[model samples]
Target: MTALTTPREASDRGGPVADIGPLPARRGRRQHRLAPLIFISAAVVLFILFFLWPGALGLLYSFTDYRGVGDLNFIGTENYRELVGDDDFYRALGRTFLYTALAVPAHYVVSLAVAVLLTSKTAKGKSIARVVFFLPWLLSPIVTGVVWRWLFGENFGFVNHVITQLGGSSVAWQTDGTLGLLVVVIAGTWASTAFNMLLFIAAIRNIPRSYLEAAEIDGASPAQRFFKIQLPLLAPTSFLVILLTTIGAMKEFAMIQALNGGGPGTENMLMVQYIYRTGFERADIGYASAVSMVLMLILVVVALIQMRFDRKSALS
Candidate 1:
């Protein structure tokens, strides 16, 4: 057996006293503290590099007449002043808002409906149904656009072929601005519904079964149980879903680009598309940056307003 000595005895021997309890505990505590920081450092570095750095550069460029190549001349808000008076900018912004307004509610309703269906106790083949529902979301936006374009292509396309076979004329899905916008809205909703459905499913599952059982025992119909208990309880998740959907809709680009290229003469051009055209096509980087900054501000304002409304709803 190894020799054991008291602290006093060890110190008297001119040897360091054993720290049986505190040393290991302190080291463990330090490891615990450091692990979180080490884990988060990579994310922090990425956020700084990708988001903050680019955002700073964009903001700086917004105040300067920096064409993609030439010397930067500080225009001191001239880009912003011109943006304020630009008809195209306003139209794009309005279209973006319209898209968001249409998309968010559709996403909510369809996703919620799917979630409710999948979570029903009597539902069968849920796994297969979930996979099928989620497949659209797994597709690349470009692929989704291509698939939708094929389906709704104006002529020599599947839908038109079916229509012509059935004695109806081919619809102007690609060429008509309103019809094209409607197609995009439908495609966006289909692509996005799965993720929001998952969120609602998780939220619904977390709710106590007892409450639902009690509501059922009290002779509540399916709709009554949902509206009286489930819907009220879902407010937080609903808010989150709506907020995320709104932000995503506002920033949408790839799907729209692939689907219609903001076509029919910029009739459906969104704010991001407008920015892209200004910066890349027109070589007006300064104006594009200004528009980006304004769009960012608008998103911030919208988010804040939504948060305020959510808070008030919760409090009341």
Candidate 2:
């Protein structure tokens, strides 16, 4: 009896071979094509379920008079019209912008400074310093707010106690709107700095050492080297940090809420807190949804502007 050869072996030997099925390599290629889709299917599902669907519903509700319950009577753009003329809405939006303006710059400066320090060649105890610097980013926003509140509390607080001990009057941190907002800005910056610092650190470390060495050999001072080489190179990372910080500051709610409950007569109420109060506290879901849509539009516009600026900067 003749020994049977496998199809591959027969083909190799120049004999006619019967086709069995798709080869393992072809099957593997198919699996490879499918692997990414398989891995990302869960994330896509979650995005649709949690984000897209809700956003669609919110958009739909914004055109109606849905008061969290009852009949959804269609009101067209009345909610938006009302939002346009509402002084409280404008104040909240303005306050939100103010917070973003204050917080983003502070966040950028502090984070970049820390990142530069940590990434410096002559820095000491880098490992310990990195951990200490990064710890605040691990904290929940509410927790951070609560901690700051305790430190800045109006009466019987640590800060006040220290001031009084040093023969100074107790400051109205919570009651006074400006002081309250200042505390929130400080807390927000402190809470958010670590993450941005990590981004800056990565960007800085990725900068080629040869550039700095070349600059130094050309008689450039540390500040000159940084301004001419390091700072220019860090543009992309800086833009990213600014964009993210702006968005985070715009959407700030929980921290401010936990800190002063948007208190001092809604003086410190940011847009998100305003939305929450309008939707939940007052049960004006449709109008609140409209406000949220406006906020979303503002964020989209800001992101687009930043991206455009970044592209221009990159080109120039």
Candidate 3:
């Protein structure tokens, strides 16, 4: 019962026919165009305010004599010059490197092993096990540090109590510099390993089971299957884990604060801890900024190197 109208008549009548085609779609798109911007506006603002602005300001202040106070003077790399010659800074730098070197490998090895075990076909109650393992990661760093500190305390602590009960002499864990650093490393490893394990588990689970089955059918041993099949495929995830753990170890400060307070004469001082002390305690904002810039540079270079390796691995 409907009559066909010409396009010119439809246009003149302003009917629904005139409004059909791309016009509404274009209008709808234009209306929705602001929706995404609206949703992301908050994140964009926060990124600029918290990350970009602060980082830019810190970099700018590194070259100036801004002691977190009124007067500021551009010292022209004087802070960096002092940073280069500062023996304490170098000592902390070395300690940070040592921590990263030891902690990253230990964490990775343990996490990978745990991930493999958890993902195996014979594994039972993996959900419960995963939760139990990841519980430490749910706790705050300060809480973990404090609990471990107490456990490793000199007298009447759980570890020492057990040791003494076993006829071993009670050890002064937090007093000695080397022992204190060791405790920090161990605590850091325990706290962080679970998260890394989860990553590894995901990566392992993503690998096709058919590959392993074929290898096993060919009379390959478990070790051979792991090395030739799983390990090679896990290179990308391994690279990610290493880079993250290394950066984390380098920036460790809170755990040290809660555990030993960088005691035994700065023997366990991390780069971030040193930066915090310099800026907040020593009130040397400029020098602290310069140190932060150095740390940033180190992290950037490490990330770039990892990226290069990852790209090469992928290509191969």
Candidate 4:
């Protein structure tokens, strides 16, 4: 009887309630406190290294005459003031806007459709097909540029050779402003759309099969189900892809380098390429920094506008 009473006392006093009641809660509290601090610390470090420090340096340099090396002098808003009258700045801006308008939609439309097709079982050899589609993207920009340059070569090139064979005169592809820009645009689209295809493919695969099956059962066709149900659900993902691709297009330099090297007469010169020409080629660091800041402002404004539209669409 005494032994039984001893065991009951131990059970009541030394059970989980006594050992774990406040201990787990205390550990959880500690973890909660540490987690945010850890996250914030990491963010602070990364922001300082990646964005804040470089931005601060550029902002300061924009107001000075720091052309790589030697003496530097603060010149107020002279850099900005000079840009107002710079014809190159205006030209770059115009070309950039045009490029964005054309390339962004072409990329989204073609890639999304390809993604849909790739996701379909009716499609044959999906992995082999993906690899084929992705082949352009896998090559280095320099390599693509060299190949295209040879194809667009003035004489004895594949492109012109074909033209002559077809009983047409051989044209100087790179020297023709219209042809050069067109080639750049097409190559840029072809090179870029594959990555976007992969994104859409991933997003499409994650969609619940039950939802699609139910839509089919209700006599909805593939087009109607895709547009009304799938697209609506995939809205956020599409928005994200568009935003990123647009931003990327705005900053395009490599593809242009590969395709036209900023073209026949600076006609295809995008803003970043213009900025590169200004800083390194022309040796005007201060003015180039000013141009960069302007580009940054444009991107930020666009991003804000996109965010507002996204939120509005999501609510609607």
Q: What lDDT does each candidate get? A: 0.94, 0.93, 0.90, 0.86
Q: On residues 108-225, what C-alpha lDDT tens digit does candidate 1 reach at each position?
A: 9999999999999999999999999999999999998888888888876698899999999989998899999999999999999999999999999999999999989999999999
Better of 2 and 3 by TM-score: 2
Pairs clashing in candidate 1?
none
All candidates: TM-score: 0.93, 0.93, 0.90, 0.84
Candidate 2 per-residue lDDT, tens place, 181-287, comes to: 99999999889989999999999999999999999999999999888999999999999999999999999988888889887889999999999999999999999
Cα shift from native, residue 200, model 2 (Å): 0.5
lDDT of 1 at 154: 85
- Model 4 per-residue lDDT at 236: 80
Residues 190-308 of candidate 3: C-alpha lDDT, one tens digit per residue: 89989899899999989999999999999999999999999999998999999999889888988888988887778888899999999999998988999999999999998899899
What are the runs in model 1 whose C-alpha is more than 4 Å off?
A: 1-22
Question: Among these predicted structures, which one has the highest lDDT?
Answer: 1
Q: In model 2, where is the ten-residue run with the lowest total lDDT?
A: 148-157
Per-candidate Cα RMSD to the true structure, in Å, reads 3.0, 3.8, 3.1, 5.4
Give the winner by lDDT: 3 or 4. Answer: 3
lDDT of 3: 0.90
lDDT tens digits by residue: candidate 4, 1-316? 4543344566887753233335688899999999999999999999999999999888888999999998879999999999999998999899899888888888888889999999996988999989989999998767777777788787857989899999999897888877887776677777877898988998999999999999999999999989988788888889988899789989988768776788887988999999899899989898899999999999999999999999999888
